[model samples]
Target: MAGIYIFSDRADIAAEIVGFARAAGKEAFVMALGEEAAQALTNAGADKIYAIDGDSELIESYAKDIAEFLIKAGAELFAVGATPRGRDLAARVAGYLDCAMASDVVSVEYHDNQLTCVRMLYGGAVQEKQVLSGLSVVTIPAGKFEPAQGESTIEALKLKADTRVSIVETAPIVKEGVDLSKAEKVVCVGMALDKEEDLQIARDLAAVLGAELGCTRSIAEERHWLPVESYIGISGAVIKPRLYISMGVSGQIQHVYGIRDANLIVAIDINEKAPIFKAADYGIVGDLYEVVPLLTEALKK
Candidate 1:
C-alpha cells in the first residue's frame, strides 16, 4: 500500500521525480522504456526497475500494461511526468483504474499517512490543494525535483502495448535554446521595446549578467522575434531561477505564474503601476531603453 510507481517516456524525467518517492519513504519503482532508458535511469535511486521488454517506441501503447500492474501491485500512488506522452498515458490509466488524478502538480506532501498535492488552477490564478485517499496518479512538471545517483535492480516485462493505433512516421522536432527552468539567472524581454532591433539592449544585459535570455509570449508567439521555446507564460516555459529579471514585461497573471517560483523577481517597466511591479521582489520604474543599458554597465563593473 505504500509502494510508488513512477513512469515517464523520458528517462531523465522518471529519474527527477524519484526524489518525491524517496521523500515519501516508499518503495520507488521506475518504468524505463528500453535498455538505453534503463541505463540512463540506473542513477535514479529506484528500489526496482520495471522496463518494457522491447523498444516499443510508442509509450502510449502500454497504457493497459501500466494500469494493470498498479492494480495488481496495489500501488498507493502513480507518479508520472507531465509531458504530452506522459499526460496521455496517465489519463488512460486513470480511466482504467477509475482513480483520482492530479495534473501539473508542483508540490506534494505525504503527511499523517495521506498524500496531498498542490497544483495550479484557472490558468495559474489559484493553487488547488488535493488529498489523495485511494490509489491516485499525479503528473509533475520538470525542475520540481532533483534526482540522486544510486544503484538499482532492473526487471523486464513483456510488452503489452495497445495496437489499435499505428505510428506511420516519426520525426524529431528541433529546438535550440537554453533550458530556462535550470537557469540560475534569467534576463527576460517583454513587449515594451519599440522594435526587434532593440533586443540588443536586453541581450547586452543578459551578456553582462551571464544569464539565460527569456521573453514574454508575444515576443515569441506573435512577433516571432525569438523561438517558441524562449517564451515564458501560462502556456510557455515555467522557470524557477535564483534571479529572474523581467524587462518591460507587463506582468499578466499568466506571465507571473511562470516566474512565481523564482527566488528573486525583479521587474523594470516604464509605468510605475504596471502589474509586474506588484509581483516583483524589486521594481524599477523607467523606460527599459534607458534603464537596461545603465544596468548592464553596472553589472560589468
Candidate 2:
C-alpha cells in the first residue's frame, strides 16, 4: 500500500482525508501547522501529527521549515488544501522535491498502488483524470468532500528542520467590507459593464442586497477595475454561494467554473445567445446600466 500524507489547517478536513486514505488502504499521516489544527487532525484519525507554531507575519519562513519535515517524512502522495497558503506551501515543497503538482483536485482514488486524481477542467464542463506516475503533490479544493467523525489519537512528532528565509517586517493590506468567499450572496460584474463608472452601479446593487462584489478576469485584470484576487474563474476562486448574480458576464468556460456550484444563478446580458444564460437559473436579456440601478432601488425599497 502507498503512504499518504495530508497537510491541513482544519482538523475536520484533515480527518476526511484520512478517511479517504484508509478506505483506499493507504497509511495516512496528517500534519497540522498549529496546536488547534494538530488536535483536530488527531481526532480525525491521523496516525501522526506534526505541530508547528510561528507568527503569521513570517509564513513563508515557517512553511519552508515545515516543508523540510514533510520531505523527511517520506510521503509518496502528498495532499494539501487548495487555499492560498496551501498552494504556496505545495509549490515550495514540490519545487524542493522536484515533483509534479496538481491544484484544485476534487477527488482521488488508489488502484494497484497508483494514485489517480480527478479535477474539473473547462469550467466544470469536463472531469480530467490524471494518474500520477511518480511522487506527486495535490491540492484539493474545499467542500469537495464530506468530513468524517473519528476517535482522537494524536501522536506528536518533533521536527528538527530549519528555514533558510527569515522575516524582517510585515504590513497587512486590510480591505473594509465583507470577504466575497464568506458572502452568502455575491454580485459578479463582467466585461460587458462597458464603462468603469458602471462598477459603482453594481456596487450599489451589492450594497442594497448586502452582498459582496466580484468580477470576471477581464474586468479584474485587463481593465484593472477590481483586484486580481477578486477575479473568479477556473484559475481563480471557486465559489459555492446561495445566490450568484452575474451582470454582463458572457460566461466564458473559464469564468463559469467559479460559480457552477451556486444554488441560484441570475444572469443579465443584452445578448440572449450569451453562454451564461444557458447555465443560469434565470436570465434577463437587456442593458445592465438600466436594469442594475432599477434592481438596486427595488431591493432597497
Candidate 3:
C-alpha cells in the first residue's frame, strides 16, 4: 500500500511535499515525469519514486494513467502542488479516484486512520478544518514546508499517453522578481505611492536591510509599477518572513494575510489610522517619502 503519493513537474515543489509527508508521519512516494525528475526528487529525500520514464509532448498527457495506477496500488493520500498544471492533474485524478479533495491546503495531519486538513477561506478571512475518510487528494501551494532529503528506490511505470492534445508552441513569460514565498525579509510597497519613481525609497530601504522588494495588489496590477509576481496577499504570494516592512500600505485584510506570519512587522504611512498599523509590530505615522530615507540611513550606521 502506498503511504502518501506526491506529484509535481518541478522537483523542488515535489521535495516540499516530501517534507510535508514526512512531517505528517508517512513515507513519501512521488511521481516523476522522466528519469531526471525521479532521481532529483529521490536525491531531495523522497522515499519512493514512481518513475514514468518517457518523452512526451506534455507531462499532463499521462494523468489518466497515473490516476488509475495509484487507485490500483491502494494509494492513501495524493498530495499535489497548486501550480496551473498541477491543479489540472489533481482534479482529473480526484475525479477518477472518486475521492474528496482539498485545494490550497496549508496544513494537514494524519493520525489513527484520520486525515485532518486545514485551508483558508474567503481570502484568508476564515480557516476551515475538514476531516476526510480514506483515499483522499489535496493540493498545496509552495513555501508551506521546508524541503526534506532522503534515499529512495525507483519503481518504473509505463502509462498510455493522451493522443488528443498536442502542443503547438511554447513561450515562457519573462518575469523580474524573486520568489517572495522563500524570502526571509521583505519590504513591500502599496498604493500609498503616488508614482513609480517613488518606489526608489522602498528599494533603498530593502537594499539596506538585505530584503527582497514586494508590493500590494494595486502596486502590481493597477499601477503596473511591479510585476504580479511581486504582489503579496491572499490572491498573490503568501510569505512568512523573519522581518517584514511595509511602506505606504493601507493594510487591507487581504494584504495582511500574506505577511501575518512574519516574525516582526513594521509599517510606515502618513495616516495614523492606516489599517496596516493595526497589523504591524511597529507603526510609524509619517510620510514615507521622508521616513524611509532616514530609516535607511539609520540602519546603515
- Number of the predicted model whose lDDT against the real structure is largest: 3
What's the true lDDT of residue 95 in model 3? 86
If both were scored by TM-score, which would come out higher, candidate 1 or candidate 2?
1
lDDT per residue (tens digit) for residues 35-72 in model 1: 67777788789988877874357888888888888888
Writing each residue's lDDT as its tens digit, candidate 2 over 124-217 gives 8899888886778888766666564565555555543345555577689675434566669999999888889888998899888878899999
Every candidate's lDDT: 0.86, 0.76, 0.87
Task: Name every residue pair that clashes in candidate 3.
Answer: 45-149, 45-150
Q: For model 3, how does the per-residue alpha-carbon lDDT over 139-183 read when each residue is reduced to its tens digit?
A: 988777899987888888788877688889999977788899889
RMSD of every candidate to native, in Å, equals 2.6, 4.0, 2.8
Candidate 1 TM-score, true structure as reference: 0.87
Structure candidate 2, residue pairs in collision = none
Candidate 3 Cα outliers beyond 4 Å, as residue runs: 19-27, 44-47, 53-55, 143-150, 182-184, 297-301
lDDT: the better of candidates 2 and 3:
3
Query: Candidate 1 vs. truth: CA RMSD?
Result: 2.6
* Candidate number with the higher TM-score (1 or 3): 1
- In terms of lDDT, the poorest run of 10 residues in model 1 is 50-59
